[model samples]
Target: MYVYDEHDRQIAAERVAQFRDQTERALAGELSEDEFLPLRLQNGLYVQRLAPMLRIAVPYGMLRSEQLRRLARVTRDYDKGYAHFTTRQNVQLNWPALEDVPDILAELAEVEMHANQTSGNCIRNTTTDQFSGVQVDEVADPRPYCEIIRQWSTFHPEFAFLPRKFKVAVNASEKTDRAAIQVHDIGLQMVRNDQGELGFRVHVGGGLGRTPMVGPVIREFLPELDLLTYLEAVLRVYNRYGRRDNKFKARIKILVKALTPEGFAEKVEAEWSHIKDSPTRLTREAIERIQGYFTEPAYDALENATELLASQRFDNRQFDQWLSHNVDSHKKPGYAIVTLTMKKTGTPPGDVSDTQLEQIAELAEQYSFGEVRVTHQQNVVLADVRQDQLFELWQSIEPMGFATANLNTLTDVICCPGGDYCALANAKSIPVAESIQRRFDDKDFLYDLGDIDLNISGCMNACGHHHVGNIGVLGVDKKGAEFYQVSLGGSSHHDATIGKILGPSFAQEDMPDVIAKIIDVYVDNRKEEEPFLETYRRIGIEPFKERVYA
Candidate 1:
């Protein structure tokens, strides 16, 4: 994790003071609601359906244990006793009083955290794989690049106010697309040429909303030094020509569609040619300095605990299942990456209580290093857990309601705070997610079903990233009544694709059954050991549609 220096601390303190004044003025009736809207938004405060929601950025999803404890304290003292983790790898306080937000910002500043750029039409938090440096297959750690992007984008005067919100993601893994870069405003996939020179395969206009799209490859190879300059060029083009007259069509994806990929690339290239040699070009020293912050921790020289783990797996069926589902191979020999799933059957997905947050911080400090990473799937990750201590960690977290053993299963749903919080939502998303989880409570059945990415969103804004789920459930409004629409064959991995609509929307009551039918179709048609996504692609959505709509 990158520790804040004096400069960073000073800026954060100044922002807190500025927002305090702004908030006080608004509360005093000195600033109108309309006048305070942008100012509050810049500070990541939103007036939601019932109360104010404050989003706190977890830069590239990294957090120190101290920061987590600070968040727990904030939740306990200021807001409700719990907070929601978002798919963008950020955390949200759903019940903060409008007057208490400035105080909350001040609290966050003490821990080197803030709510800046978590909302509004500006560059949002840059995210990457939760298992960035620890994962086995990545070409190099992507967090340094993500940090670089975050520094360049945060409060950049040129891009302070864009037509709409812009999101950027980086992926360095050779085999996985955990970052889902293809669906971001700017997706940077680290790659190397024949001479082993590091560069990025850039994708632009990838987004999911009313208009879903897998962003096209704008530049096949952008050199490492020009990363910031290339990004500036892209933003410049979008700021100049992106739609502002209509909020619905203001995304950079919309602008790219209107201009076509080639035309958009030409514009970006022309813009880049003029400013490519500017000071923004990252130097070797600068890149190395950022990279230094993310170097490996003090890892012990130990071999994998193969024998002990095997014995443990042989003894406990439940622990074995958890190991298979929640644990991932680490780049280090003796370590493993563990995901603390938030999707328990009864609890709302991603909602962590204050007590649990504090406990998790302790667990991170005791088991892994004193650092944690938030995943895009709304889960917490202990990225450097020793393989030998897997069972104890699993046992500890299981009782804490964090060890669900449903990672990538149908029950591990990605969902958003819909009508329950967001005024923009057409229906409630949490209930739908809970209903599905409850219907598939059998752990054995879920294990048999294999990997599935099921996402739910309350509306077309796609905050839940429903478009990329293997089975996507989207809430829709029909004559003022809430309805649920289903989509099939969507994926957020390396071969990303938008899900196809199954059929006519169903009533809320039919969602569990509808999902059941789709699962039944996959089970009946799939080859032995095939995943849900592969089966859907091979057999096509027609079979699932027939089973679901029939």
Candidate 2:
């Protein structure tokens, strides 16, 4: 976690004061609703369907235990007693009073957190793998780069208000992409050439909305030093030429489509030529300074607790299942990365109560070096848990409702707070997610089905990232009735692809069965040990479509 210096603290305090004044003016009728729209948005406050929603930025998904406790306090005192963790690794409060937001901002400032650039057509949160530093297979930890971008983009005068909201993601792992970079406005993949020089494989124009697209590779290799300059070039081009006439078509992805990838690259190159050698070019000193914030923690020198873990697993079936699903191998010998599942059977996915937040903070402090990481799948990660303490951690978390053993399974759904919270949503999404989770409650059945990414969004906004789910569900309105649309073969991993629509929409009541039919088709046709995604690709969407629509 990066601790805020005096400069950072000063800026955050100033922003809070500014927003406090703006909010007071708006409440006092000195500013009208139209006048207050952009101001509120800039502070990550949105007027939702029923109430105001405030999104708090969790930069690159990193959090200190103290920060988590502060969030719990905010949620408890200011709004409802819980908050939703978004797919971008940000946190959203669904019931904050408009007047209380400035006070909330002031509280967040004390913890070195804010809601700036979280909304309103500006560069949003920059995200990466939750396991960034702990993953063994990565070329290098991408958090330092993510932090660099976060500092550069926050309140950037040049990109404060783009044509539409822009998102950027970084991925350093070659084998997997926990961060869905391919679907961002700017996606950077860390790579090395034959000379062992670090650079990025850049992708542009990737997004999901009414028009879904997998961002194309715009540059083969952008040198490490030119990271900020190249990003500035891309944003400059978009700011100059991106659509502003129509809100629906204002995303950089739309601009890239109209101009074509080659044309976009040419424009970016021409723009980069003018300022590539400027002071924005990263230096070794600056990069190392940012890297210092994310160096390895004081890890205990201990061998893997292979025998102890084996004995524990042999004794408890529940703990063994949790270990298999929620635990990941860490780069260190004695440590393991544990994902605290937020998708319990009855609870809304990713909705952690204030008590749970406090518990998580305590657990993080006790077992994971007082640090936590939020995953894009709406889960929390204790990235440095010792292997020897796995059983105790599992037992402690189970009572707190964080030990669900359904990491990549069907029950571990990625969902959004749809019509229940958002004015933009066409239908309610939480109930649909809950319905699906309830229908797929059998642990044995889910374990046999294997890794499945099932995402649900209330509308085309794709807040749940429905486009990338192996089996994606979308809420749709047909003649004033709520219906669900299904998509198959979608993935957000290294081989990212937008899901294809299965067929005509089904009544909300039929959603659970429809998903079951899609799974049935996959299970019946899949070869031995094939995951849901590979099976869908091998068998194609036709079989699943026929089963689903039939």
Candidate 3:
């Protein structure tokens, strides 16, 4: 958890006061809905289906135990007794009164958090790998950079009103947990060359909506120091030439397509010529200062793996199962990265009750290093769990219904609130997610379909990230009736690609069988022990398409 500096604290406090006035003016009818729309959006307030939903920005999904406790208090005091963690690494409270939004923002600001740029047509929260600092393969933690970008973009005078909402994601690892980078407005991947100099691989114009595109690599390697200046050039190009006539065609992705990656790169290169190495360019000192914020947490050195923990693994089959699926390798010895799954069998994915949030906070103090991370996959992560205490932690979490061992499995579905909460939605996505989970509840069956990512969204904003799942399902409306569109072959890892739609949409009731048929295709054709992605790549979508359509 990066603590805010005096400057950071001041800006957040001032911004709250500004938003409070904006909210009061809007409510008092001094500000019309048109005038208030962007203002409210900038504060992460959305007037959705039934009420105002406040999306609290959790930058890079990183949080301190105290911050998590504040969020729990926010949910308990203001809205319902729970909150929905979104795929963008943000959290949403569904039932906030429009007037109380200012107070909510004030509460968040007290904890050095805010909803700035959370929903506006400006740069949104800069998401990064949840395990940025803790993961073994990470080149460097991306959070400091994310925080810098957050500060720069907060009220960027020129970009306040863009053609459409813009998103930027940074990943510093060899593996891409921050998926489908090819589909973001800007994707930054930290890279080291043969010379061992650090920089980034810049991808531009990747996005998913009605038109999904894998971002094109415009710059193979940009020196890390020129990050801000180079980014400004990219945004300058998009802000100047991006479409304003049609909202549907206004995204940077559309403009990138219109210009082509090569041509776009030329434009950006030309702009960068004047701005590169400018005063805004990051200096060694700046980089060091930012890196200092994310320096590794102190860990006790314990070289030996506890034999007692090894024995406990075999003694409790349930704990063994949890260790197998929910635990990830840690860079530290005698410690593990534990994913506290929220995708329990029958509940809505990412919906954490107030009590569970408090429990997680307590657990972070007792087991983890007083920190927890909310992952993009809608689960809580206890980043540094001691191996010896694994069984006790499992015992604590299992009763709260948080120990479902479905990480990367089909049952570990990423879903949005959908029609139940979203006004933009055409059908219910949560129920569909549950139905799919029910059909694949058997662990043996799920394990056979190894490392499958199933994502669903009620409508086309692709909030559920349906465009990048190994098995993607999109809900739609046909003549006022609910239906789902299935797609296959999409992935969100290092080799990211968008899934292709199968055919005509299927009726809602037909989804379970359709899913079963797709799995059957995998089972019948997969070469021994091959994962879903490997099998899909080797066999292509032809066989699955045949089985699914037939």
Candidate 4:
């Protein structure tokens, strides 16, 4: 909910003007594709399998009603009538003309949004928990810190052209909703010491792609004020020493593995020695000012319990189903967090139509604050819905096709816009997700499965976070035939781990049956309604692997 300051406004506008000129040059053939590639990438444009894709940054996944409307308008006017919300909490417009990108950026700037540093070797968006301010277990709100880092990393002269693209995430919650301190280039978790002072638990080298590894803790408790300076040290060491000859080996994860966690920490510390208390360190006053921007919203003091809500829950079994799946507790007593499930049966995981976007904007204004959040799992969040209004909100959401009650069930899948939209993908991921959903449409059975995350990536890049899903499916091609590979036990939680593959890949036709076998193993072997993950951990992959392969 941080409004753009005048300085932010001016900077965004100026960047758009510069890009408009660059766009003109590129279209006129004054600049070749090679010349425009880096520039376009810096502005968040990528030439995909079908067309040029423009990624618009949604900082920390927060968006005002006005901003959402602007995005809707941009897609309606410039590209296709829909945008794909990415796991990084950004939106990708799939069909923007190369010439019209500058106009799109200008429109985004009007809403205090931009695509800068959304790609390239500089730090990408500094994501935080989607429920940052509203989560019941927040140790501190992480947005202000995210905003600070966003400013520092945006077009930083020193880091603009790194050996490879870098990403960072921070979490300030007891529970890790942001999946921070996991498979990130750098992960920061906020903590309080024995003396009750704010600090960070720093993790270095974790990354996902062809290689996935959980980051190792390097610094146990870095003080709050030294965040920027300490991060500068980490980046400086990586920039100076990370491999430049091979793009595959250029990520910080590779360097961290080569140097070992202890050695990486030492290198960063040696670099930090000269600049530990430099002027770059965030000041108390500055932190306070940034924090002020993220203060909690005003709420009515009336009790939240309602007879209408109770009666509706009693009257409609469908509403009750949605309530069970879509609602989450809020830090505020009178409020709740509502996830508007985009994963309706048989649809693309995160696709929303232009009309649906407008309706969501209206629903956000009616049921909660005039704000919505795009979650990493590609669902929209109505973060401040009143508990009393849950049923009516569900009714409004039902007609818009947003009332799928499968928040974290097997149906709530995370899938990339694979071969359908992305050229990098070897096979289509969305249809595979739909196939699995169709096979598992039994509501009672899915609910019994309990909090499962099914993620599908079209390729080895792991963009869909396939490696961390309780049920991960990756699509690969063999001799012009699309095959699906299954992995089990991967999780992105307090006990994070990448999953192991279950033998050879299966043909697309065999995937649903393969999944059924995996589930059957869990059902037969589990102890008293244990979740899929719990069962997997208890019995290990051997049981499922044996069943599937045998």
Every model's TM-score: 0.99, 0.99, 0.98, 0.98
lDDT for position 52 in model 1: 92
lDDT of 3 by residue, 1-550 (tens): 5689898898889998998898889889999999999988988999999999999999888878788888899999999999998988899999999888889888988887788889988999888888877788988778888877876787899889999999999999886655446678999988987799888899999888889888989999998888899999999999999999999999999999999999999999999999887887888998787778777767898764668767888888878888889988888898888999999978899999888888999999999878888888999899998887788899999999889998989999999999999999999998889988998889977876788899999999899889999999999999999999999988777788999888899987889889999999999988988998889889888898889888
Model 2, 406: alpha-carbon shift in Å?
0.4
Give the deviation of candidate 1 from the true structure as CA RMSD.
0.9
* Residue 67, candidate 3: C-alpha displacement in angstroms: 1.1
Off by over 4 Å in 1: none
TM-score of 4: 0.98
How would you encode candidate 4's per-residue C-alpha lDDT over 167-232 as one tens digit per residue?
988888886645545888988888999999988999999888888888999999999999999999
- Of 2 and 4, the candidate ranking higher by lDDT: 2
Better of 2 and 3 by lDDT: 2
lDDT of 2: 0.94
Model 2: per-residue Cα lDDT over 393-434, one tens digit each: 998999899999999899899999998989999988999999
lDDT of 2 at 205: 94
Candidate 4, clashing residue pairs? 49-423
